[model samples]
Target chain A: MDRSKLHSVIALDMVEFEFNGTPHKSPPQTTVAGLLESLGIEYRFCAVEVNEEILPKAQYSIYEVKPGDRIEVVTLVGGG
Target chain B: MSTNIHRLSVAGKLLESRVIVGTGKYETLDVMRESLDASGTSCVTVAVRREKLYDRDGKNLLDYIDLKRYTLLPNTAGCFNAKDAVRVARMGREILSDLGNPGADWVKLEVLGDTKTLLPDPVATLEACQRLVEDGFKVLCYTSDCPIMAVRLKSAGAASVMPAASPIGSGQGILNPNNLKIILEYLKSDDPDYPVIIDAGVGTASDVAEVFELGADGVLLNTAIAHARDPIMMASAVRNSAIAGRQAYLAGRIPKRLYAMASSPEEGVITSRPW
Candidate 1:
């Protein structure tokens, strides 16, 4: 395949999503745990929200990310 | 009676310390950890927020906080509305429950009406309290020192009603003592043991003492200790002040009178000559 054709095919397989308000690109069907692993975060230490809904830790390994999904990974922070 | 034995109980959870410190505003995580230890609080407040990713420093707050020692009272500090507060409450619960902490079933709920004041919205706070209670959460609701709002929160099933001494982080300290007194009377009138915590606006150790002196069940503060010149020393001071204040409250002071009452016996008047 030509170089440009190969690049277009690869782009089709990638998914664009939002992570903590920043845009991110990941492969299709990337699970929450997979995304966290990519970010060097431990799934057990934080809570994940997909499209503003909390994704249970039990579902982190099973839940798949879709394009345009807004994923928020949250943990404890210092506050009054 | 020693204040140490008189634990503060809220929703069946007994906290050994009457002072609940917030783990916030310290210069560093090390200071926060040491301050928490110095404060001698059995519970500490923490907020839930988006994690910082891809940073060179990979430290987490949990690393500093010993779960076995401190019950994490997760707070929805930045949430402005009921829906967002409820959502954050659930997330907090989820995180703690996964870690097998007892604080999983409870949350410190704050729904601010305005950003500048950081004062809770009465309507939103009440609504969020009810929803959280319905969800099996023991909500510790934070609000202004409005006695009526405190009553409303109690009626809505909050485990503890935390009234602000002043606007959050302002450090002005107990702006309305009369309203707080009324809150204590109204809340404890029926259930004497219902916990009423004084949260926010504590400027120094004396502010904490004043809170317990007013007969509050407990005092929750952050900036007073965390932002002090010496946080650990301030924590210790606040801790001792809480004990001293509670002891003084139980000891009871003499009633206020227009004329001065001499501490010494009037019969021994040889050294007492008043013009």
Candidate 2:
């Protein structure tokens, strides 16, 4: 979502970052848990990477994602 | 003979069924699940993709097939290079851990040659297999009916070496049986139990039967079942065909002859023939 145009950075305290190779913005949903929730990503279905390091599931809610962090998420899908 | 239940063993692990279905091309998740049930498979193949930002509502694929009930053979389906495949395999393993199922660390490695043929690139596949195996992942590599590559993969500690019967999703069915046969014969001879699975190009029940007869340890297919007019029925047929072929292989067929020999006793048939 293009939330960048919605408000100034200081107003909503939102952070913009790269997710799955695309630009994504959230309300500073700082931690991996909050970022995943804000992205509506099923926590159990995927592996998350913040800034090139694989963030363990146990620390998803603890490891904070910040601006300029390149996050990658992946999951298994239906295909041959 | 006792029905002791023949098992298809791959890298010391015994499979419950000879047919492995893929979780793709099904009209619905229910159809896919039902077809897997009908096929009597204990495992299913899946593709790994980047997660998207959306509140998925409908039943996910995981909802249809429980991970504990089935072995999820995740594949690096769209990967064209070793780097991508390695990255995908790492992510797949991490996903497994994230799901609290760290034991299910199997990945079906496939590095494609092109979009049209959908054949595996030998260089990339072997490289990926070696890397993944070293990284402690059970690699079931998907390659063409290239016997040398199969051996290399087995040497690289791949859990199983899967060679395509034909092009992916082509439904052509064993386009080159000789190559596949050579693969089965070669791999099994090395360890007397090395699993050589055939994936792709299975069009019908007879294809499954023929490949099994050729000594394929197992079959992995998706388009053949999911695209069938009756996916459930096709799944049933494939299950029976696999068993039948396995039995035929075990029972041993008569050797080929130049001409047919009379089955009836010659003395009993001679007098009547003259009259």
Candidate 3:
């Protein structure tokens, strides 16, 4: 019934999202690193951008994902 | 008899070979490796794009390439905007640094516009070139075969200004030698050794030779060899043709004239009615 309890309750009920243009759902206690790890995307060869701003690789461990975060993960592939 | 070894000097690095080969479009890693070996290229290009890697062996495209033997030139091939190109260049720099080649800092900028044509957007290319150069990154920018654009890119601190012979992957092969000649003249007039590499649309060995004959410092292509029926053999031909063309250019070609002129001296030639 309190404001802080209401905020926590709303956060617990969060879901759904976008990653590299595809719609994705967020599991409970998912960080950026956790999401990428679960998807089997290796971090060493790629860099991540959250909501248009590129985050440093070291921040991957602590950068928490929001419900509407537009994440873009890019890597180097065979191209001309 | 000029037996001097021609080196491709750009961004202050002296490369043993002037031909820069592309690392894409090959059937397999072994094929790519063999083709590269046959091409005699001291440098090879690699494009930056997102690829899914699920294997634990770290078997990647980069792994196939021996960085110690070849200079891996990372390119911003598909970027259509300046910002994206700059980001990709930075990521490439980071990736190479992480791979233990910390001094490998050159980037090939290709800000392509219109997917159908796949030509570079001049404005975006220039903008990316300037920004990347200012960022302390050596930029080899791919531009249209227009002297003005080539000049502008050189002024923007591009270590090498590349003009496409035709269009990327078109296999047109020196569609406009005059345009490339103009680009070379404009850039080299000021700095006679300014690096002007022909970037794309090369079809075969003769195409490579024609570009060299036109006085371009180097040529870069992917599909010409990778898509060939025999990639390694084609690569060998390309290498030989590049060398031959460069040598011919150095050897001094005969001048064109409206009327025929005897190569032999008239005095030395015996007349039909011998005196």
Candidate 4:
């Protein structure tokens, strides 16, 4: 197999998604928990929403990230 | 006088303090914490926002707040429509539930109409309130000082109807007491124990006192205490005012009169009127 062809095959395995309104790329089949772990956020302190639907904490480990998914990680802040 | 313990009860939850303060607009987090302590508030409002990434420091608002001391009342402050408000409310519930807080099942629902005055959108507010209530939430609906809207919200199953005294953070201080009075009368007409709280536009201690004296069950404010020249001192004043106003309301103020009646008998008056 050609070396350039092998590199292109690996690139197709990655998924493009939006994390907190910014473009991000991750490997296919990455779970929300895995993504949070890579981001270094303690999942227990924050809430997550994927594609405008709230993802319960129980589903973080089971739900897989897909291409074009919008993810938001939110935490408590000062407000009235 | 017989001493009786008074507490604010809403949707089966009882709070020792009637004054609810917010966690925003403070000059510093340390000052905000101190001001909260000084305010003698048992419940504080917080907002939900996207987490700030790339920061090695792990400090957050929960670090400054003693969760054991104050109940975290999550609010949908910036949402301008019903859909966004409901989503935010759900997110808030999820975070608080995970943390094992008592406030996890409730939300301070605010659907704003615009950004200029920060006034609440009555239509969206009612829509969101009903949705939250049906979803097993003890919704504390924030609305304008419109008695009609207040009554509508209560009928939609709001735990508490919080009417704004003025615009949010305007510091105008109870612009229309008559409307607030009407809200109190209608909401508490049959259900006398219904909690109608004044939510915003408190300028100083006097504003807090007036809210209580007007028979409101409680007052929720933020900028009045947080943005004060001396936030800690302002918090203390607000604390005392809440107590004083509640007492005054219980005491029952005398009726207003255009003509004054002499306290001493007219026969006992020795000096003639200057007029």
Candidate 5:
């Protein structure tokens, strides 16, 4: 596996967070959860939507992520 | 039933159907899809949460539904105050705008003050609704069974006021019909065009029908239909029940009676009990 090629810009919609830039040509078959785990960022109370498609938390293990994907991760916060 | 026809208009768009469904709690995507199709609902509500778009892997639930079919109503589902609701509403607008869906201004404003009952914080909800409306967002406020609050919401420019039949996911079914009826009557008297939807606490199709019969413009249900053994079938039943109830109301129901109706002929004098 080429570590240098695994760099590609990952975008986080949350203002408080940032995806350390895109992951390059790593494996195209990376799971969403695997990618997040690699980044050392664990989202406890959030839901992810890729390219306007909502990904259920349960399917993160099987779902694959690709380059040039606009990802949105929304977290729950307190307020009335 | 008055000969005058009733129409429900939200954000200047007229909807012939009055049943609104929530896209949550289905065991499977197929069941959800089938349920929505059966519900005949033009609008379906969704909640927004924070998560990474592209994680270590693949596609998400957002792709499951055909956005072209049903109207997407983003709700401030977990927000507990007006400020949070405003923030989420802004995020919702941005998400929609970025997606090239300008119609995202329509929001189901929900501000739960308590976690136990998931009750609507009427005061905060109204505040949020007022601000959203002022910001050009078409607000549909989920409130409690308070006529005064409902009236205030209507007056504050809410596109619609959804008074809860009971707490969220409680399946209580119009805990206070008298209060809801009063709210309906007030809306009719003040602004006959105001749309009043009974949101939450609806256990079954009959519950939905009862609300519609009580003169609500529509009903918003999620758990009842989604959690059913046969969600799709229940959705169909709820849809039909809502329509039937609305039609029954339009058809004018007989006034309630204080006593039982006499089964025998009063004047004909039938000699039946010759003991």
Candidate 6:
């Protein structure tokens, strides 16, 4: 396996929000918040889940991102 | 003197009006508030999500709704299982309690089995309803248009069973009227204590009227009124239509007939016939 070409595909509710721009490609070693920040995106009003485990808002900075991880980010709009 | 018409009551609150509105889809908060007031809804259902708590500074969606005006019925709209539904219901209770609105005990339980149709999973829905009811929460379950399922929900201690008229947000308008009517009849005859609230699949005022006329205790809707060109006007129209339907149902409707009946007297009146 080519270590440099390896990338982690972060899926957001079945839609892949690919993060492949990192030079240090050894599992990326980035927090979920950091990954979103690197992508120039902010968590407006959404909840994040990694590997079917709900990520608390306070712990987004501590949790690490991994390859083959299915992340779900649900944004609340409006409905009844 | 004629006896006063009976209205649906949940947890000791008498819901004189059978139209439950949703506080979503309006262009502005003011419009939503105006439409709710104009619609004369005694109860309004709202969806609860974790993200809704994170607002700018102190602004929140709950702040827009007036607690004194209508009874709040928080729903687990996005939950897909019993565990998630229970979690959402607890969060809703916490938020309501913190807001000094302790009476928001009613929950519109929804457990979607599939995302495409937003259909309720009957097994999960019943399981969650049982838990919520045991936890001292009034459960208004969103279920399928299946009479047996509805009976099971009612038997499992649901405050009310809300069967969809069609798929959620489809605007198909009572795709299974026979089933809904059967559910209504079954509840009225078998239990006669449970309230049957027709939820979802309503497109306009006429749709609302049809549900009410079918003997449903109430109608819960959102898109039909909120997404209308003139939401306030449409809200009022729907409100009136619901009231009309309820009154008509109470007044009793004549049975449907495939053949027309002769109105004129047969003995006194003579008519030309082409034999």
Top candidate, metric DockQ: 1
User: Which prediction has more favorable DockQ, 3 or 4?
Assistant: 4
Candidates' C-alpha lDDT = 0.90, 0.83, 0.84, 0.92, 0.75, 0.76
Lowest-lDDT window of 10 residues in candidate 5 chain B?
Answer: B52-61
- Residues A1-80 of candidate 6 have per-residue lDDT tens digits of 45443432322222233332212222346788885665444454345666545576677789877656666544323467
| TM, chain A, every candidate | 0.91, 0.74, 0.77, 0.87, 0.55, 0.57
The DockQ-based CAPRI class assigned to model 2 is medium
lDDT of 3 at A71: 82
The candidate 1 chain B region of ten consecutive residues with least summed lDDT is: B1-10
lDDT of 2 by residue, A1-80 (tens): 36776555455586778888988776655788987776677877788877767788889988877788899988777887
Model 2: per-residue Cα lDDT over B59-129, one tens digit each: 55777877776778788999999988988877877877645542358888999989999899999888889
Error of 5 at B106 (Å): 0.6
Candidate 1, residues B1-275: lDDT per residue as tens digits? Answer: 23454478877888889889998889999999999999989899999988887563888889999998888899999999999999999989888887887798889999999998898999999999999999999999999999999999999999999999998888999899999999999999979888999999999999998999899999999998888999999999998999888888988977899998878887857775578
Q: Between the candidate structures 1 and 3, which one is better when assessed by DockQ?
A: 1
Off by over 4 Å in 1: B1-6, B268-275
Candidate structures ordered by DockQ, highest first = 1, 4, 2, 3, 6, 5
RMSD to the true structure for each prediction, in A, is: 1.8, 3.3, 4.7, 2.4, 8.7, 8.1
Best by TM-score: 1
Candidate 3 C-alpha lDDT tens digits along A1-80? 99999988876776566788777777666788998888887777676778767777778889878788888776666666
Question: Model 4, which residues run further than 4 Å from truth?
Answer: A1-10, B1-6, B54-57, B262-275
Candidate 5, residues B26-71, lDDT tens digits: the string is: 8776777788889888778877766444552333344555667666
Reference-based TM-score of each model: 0.96, 0.91, 0.86, 0.93, 0.74, 0.75
TM-score of chain A, model 4?
0.87
